[model samples]
Target: MTRAAELPGAASLVLASGVVHLDPAPAVFAAMLDGWAMQQRTRFLKASTIQSRTDLVRRFAAYTNEYPWQWRPVEVEAFIDHLRSGQRPIVVSTARGYQNTLRLFMEYVTDVRYAWPRECEEKFGRAPVQILHEWNTVAHVAEYEGDPRRRPLTYDEVQALFDAADGRVEEIRARRRKGALAAMRDAVLLKTVYAYGLRRREAWGLDLTDLRHNPKARQYGRCGAFYVRWGKSSKGSPPKRRTVLTVPEMDWIVPVLEQWLDEIRPGFGPGRLPALWVTERQSRLSRRSVNEAFEAARDAAGLPEELDLHCLRHSYVTHLIEFDYPERFVQDQVGHEYASTTALYTGVSDEYRNRLLQRSLDRHADRWSVS
Candidate 1:
């Protein structure tokens, strides 16, 4: 596949310890890293973040069967269009993530080689960038029009979901000790993430030090930014940090976490939890584990199958919104980089629409009201 691109004087694209050199394209001197490569650089993120990006890229490669430039722009646009046809919107974002991946790849290739043949081709009118064909302006607006069915679950449902997850964690802890006190440790692990509303990557990215109740301990909210190593350029995530908490309720989880810390973790001690979560095998847990863990709990709790791991985070924020927590607080807690992004979480829930509608009519007031 690379040979085809090289006919125009493409040179060897070498990668050793992440220093890439695309030959002939001496301008391509930078290394392209997915999540896994970034993982080696910092202890801030859980292994799962790396795995997710790797999984995403692998899925893209498997589906496409060739490198990006090998496919015609029409072919890439077709795949984008096919994904958009699905009712599930997350599928589209998942597909779009590849664009980020490719952009990173191109960025690295451009840096390492100083310039690439593709640019030469583009300049000479031999190659063209693909247009995003799946969306029209109005339709694009409609595409993100919040789902009417997606109002957050009630408080009872939220508790029920966790209570359910607790049971499964108990079973996993019991069935697979792989450790001395995993059961007790896991219950708190499950609660801290779901109750606080962390995305799967956030949930997995925690280090034990991140949960520590001390000033010196690094903050989870700032992991992306505070740990400059985890920042953009290398990791290719949003270039900001989210808010983490100093919850007194975190006191509740401390002992179990402490127990897991002193006994189970690799570099266990005061001020040292190399990573927050781990596998039954005692290795760093991946985002996949968090998903599997949540799914197990959700299924066992008899929650709807549609209840994804992210739904719990959504439910947490919606509960805060319903209860009228400050918008900034909610945004910070959930790690939304954009206000528009935050609004989607805060305003898009069906509960608010229902609440607004409840105040609408004068005529039905007497009939519907007990007063």
Candidate 2:
């Protein structure tokens, strides 16, 4: 039999004389986690995602008081139970995400290419097994598991929010407040978010040059299309890109942006800043500022507390469907990879549904009358 020390790959460093006599199981386990993190970085996983997965694995290891080689299915169940017993118990979706991270980590460690399993086996006399099975893990039963209270704002609510935002700017100006310009920026930012159906980061990531003129809609001039360069990405991919065309319903924003770019933005003395939304510091606005702007507007409009900035995106989707835009067109406009993902954001009002039903009835009546 070949000595484990002579085994091919990194496992040779840990094993000797058919046994892991040089490195202890704990040391090997730590090294395996380090290697896994490095591998994830090489795969271009987001730093935040990599950190989150590492933390989950570390927490699991700490909970079971055992390394990966000693981890059993029962320990996995216990750790999940502990998570449920916490003060802020993990939600089903979060728990499922945790399980997925754990499963992926296990898969990496046990993969034949990694040599971790062989090293663990040489050290502990047993290899790591994938403890999370279909029976043990949470199933993805729903496409959308977001809070039920969070839904698209009514048309009236959207108008009210925008009005309140504008009102805030006016209030600040009337009081001779120092942040009057910033308040105006916030007001326009909120409107732009609703107009373009933008996610928070996507809205902030906008640059001055992103405002493109659609050759087809020359009447709208420079505000005909929004070139979104930082749309959401999946896994380790770069940000997705899409162009959101201006529709007749949102053409009003053309002038709003035109006035801002031609007048208000220059007044800020941006100098050479390229960001569409700028702060008093002459830097790009942060995501938190975007959230706070929406929150202030939502509260001033007397909307429900559960209504968040994301609800603006939901409202955009609902309104687009009501505007008779094709489903695929709406999906592409919002940068959704799938029609189903776009469907999840749609919360059409009962009134709109009734209108559709009424239209169907009217068509049937006309057909019967002609016959």
Candidate 3:
């Protein structure tokens, strides 16, 4: 018999030999999770990812009232069904993600490299199996699985959103409310997000030093590009890095950012704080605060509830397309690895599509003319 140390997977390392428990089932389940976490840590996976995966497994176990060894395809199905039937059901993409996370956990435990199966079978009457199947899980049928309502705001809508954000600052100041400074910061923050086509974390994670001067665009000075250090990362990888250049169309943001850094930001008195956006408490602005700011602006603009802060990113992609920027340029600006991903964010207006159609027809006018 192989000692726990000799087992290939880390699972056995959590199961000390001769360490009996009052409840063997829960003990073994916890060992499986601990082993899996240790294994994932060795791969340099994010702590949040490991914690979320472990939590999902625990939730699934509780929902099914069974241990990992007792989980079956039916339990997976029922768990998802219960989630979908809830008052606030998960979206298709969210459901797919949950299923995939559960599947990955199952795979880790059942993998022979981990030795979870052999240990469970010896300890219990059964062993864990991969319960999530392709047929049972949500299929990745569409390139874009987001809500259809979540789309690019039109030029007018974008203007309205910004106007509302600006109006918020005035409203607070007029009412002599305490949050006028915060409102001003939020207005500029939203504009910065659209200007850079940044994701929420990328925007919030920005630091003062990340602003870089582009030699060719000397007029914008240090506002020429942003060194995005908190870009979305691949699994088991550190945050990706990218330089998002300030395009000519969005040059208006140059003055906006400059004013914020020089005039508005100092009001927060965030002495020695390196963050680009600081709160009243002289701390870095949080991602949740950014979301709340956008929501307030969206509501004030009378935009649909489905239109969230990400719509600004979508709008950036769409407007860039309409501006005749190359697809590759737009993709690179947004740090997308593939142009196809950029296309999913683009929701060009019908007028822009019609203009494209007109250009194509004009190019073929001689061929289209009657003989």
Candidate 4:
């Protein structure tokens, strides 16, 4: 049987020896989407990602009140404008993602192998063409498009945040409040995130056994390194894994983790629970809980509301650079595939920049004196 014969309502298009004629344009468009989704599944894309792309296409179709075969570049522009003018306007990055999804869908439909192009041409007299163009879409201007208000906390602010986190436990305990143990866990978890330069999911997905000892950092015992099994993955790939070596600067985590394991965790009756951070129910801590913990600490510290849990990781990168760690080493430490990506996370303080300028001037003066 021919490919067209296999699709619903397309058997009429199949003639002797598997030659395909044009079918109804609308029916072919539906089959084309099904085929595209099947292709995406075969490529190992996550179900969530595929669903999101499908939703975007449906939204676009709804906006124009037309089928894929009838879409035009003008409709694409108008749809983007509608998104921008909506109650909750989409950001540039989000808009770019939507545009890319449309472009890919159009590419698939226009390809001859899919039969969408020929079907559309025979029915409507014109085939679907790519509507998204470079001039109409958002460009890749920078590696980071994060909020400008979000920045790495200074060393003093980090200390203040940690102190606030610890202080919360004492305040609750003094008041005879019930959640002191949970508060302590949150404090330690926040510190661990900063210490290890971890993303929220990375920290949330950690297991107790993921902690390992570094031979050179014997002083830290088994908490000398973090075996991150849930690092961020690229499209259609499994979670990336990396081992983050604990630096001496963040060695304070050693004692904290030891205390949590020996003293605090036992109170929850974790028993055979494998999660390093567990809820009162002995379940693994969630990403939402991590965000709440950081927010609570930020409010207690009297810090800016704009600073998020991610700023802790940003601080880790900036501090590593300030500590004179090699650029390549910093990139590897943060699991960044490119130095440019690591550079985006780095926001060194003015004081650190001034120190660099002074060193550069001193070197230039020494060369002049020698001449």
Best by lDDT: 3
Q: Would you list the rank order by TM-score, best first?
A: 3, 2, 4, 1
Model 2, span 94-208: residue lDDT tens:
8888899999989877876777777667557998889999999988988888788999988899999999999998888888888888878888899999999999999989999
- What number of clashing residue pairs does each candidate have, in the order they appear? 18, 0, 1, 0
> In candidate 4, what are the lDDT values of residues 91-154, reduced to their tens digit?
8888899999999999877766656677677767888888988998889987777678999999
- State TM-scores per candidate: 0.55, 0.90, 0.95, 0.88
Candidate topping TM-score: 3
lDDT of 1 by residue, 1-371 (tens): 33432322222322233443445121321222332244233544435665665565455546667443343545555555666687864554455565555444434333324234354354233332333333421122333544455545666776786677566556666786543344334455566665666666666676644543335533423221111112221243343444455333333444444555556443333233366676555566776767776666667778777766677667767766776667887777676655676666643457676775777765468877775
Q: What would the per-residue lDDT of candidate 3 be over residues 1-371, giving only the tens digit for each residue?
A: 55656653466578878787887888888888888888788888899998998898888888889888888899999888899986899889999999998998898888777778888888896788999988899999888877898999999999999999999999988998799889999999999999889999999999999999999999999999999999999988899999999999999999999999999999999999999999999999999999999999999999999998889999999999999999999999999998889989988889999999999999999997998
Candidate 3 residue 156 Cα shift, in angstroms, is 0.6
Report the backbone clash tally of model 1. Answer: 18
TM-score of 3: 0.95
* TM-score of model 2 (CA atoms): 0.90
Candidate 2, after superposition: displacement of residue 195 in Å?
0.4
**Better model by TM-score: candidate 1 vs candidate 4:** 4
